[model samples]
Target: MSSTLQLVGMGVLAIIALWVLLQLVGIVFSIVSTIVSFLVSLLLLAIIAVLVYFAFTALT
Candidate 1:
């Protein structure tokens, strides 16, 4: 009975550890995704601004 109880306790602890690790990894990935998205948007806006400026210059 003691051996069985110890096995069960170890299993529970392992599951909890895995859950915490996955949560941390998910959070890190989410932060990286947000940063990458912001950078991409900023780059696109800069490109569009340059195009508009040149277009207006041509018309003038």
Candidate 2:
């Protein structure tokens, strides 16, 4: 009966460890996604600025 109890405790510990690891990985991915989104927005703004500059020069 004591050996069975030991096995149950070990199983619970292993499950907790896996859960913590998955949570850490999720956090890292979220941060990377945010950075990529910001970079994309910056690129779009740069393109729009270039187009506007050319249009203004043509009108003059």
lDDT of predicted model 2: 0.99
Worst 10 contiguous positions by lDDT, candidate 2: 12-21
Question: On residues 1-60, what C-alpha lDDT tens digit does candidate 1 reach at each position?
Answer: 999999999999999999999999999999999999999999999999999999999999
Model 1 TM-score is 0.84
Local accuracy of candidate 2 as per-residue lDDT tens digits, 1-60: 999999999999999999999999999999999999999999999999999999999999
Question: What is the model-wide C-alpha lDDT for candidate 1?
Answer: 1.00
> How close is every model to the real structure, measured as TM-score?
0.84, 0.80
Model 1 misplaced stretches (Cα beyond 4 Å): none
List lDDT for all candidates, in order.
1.00, 0.99
| lDDT score of residue 33 within candidate 2 | 97
Q: How many residue pairs clash in each candidate?
A: 0, 0
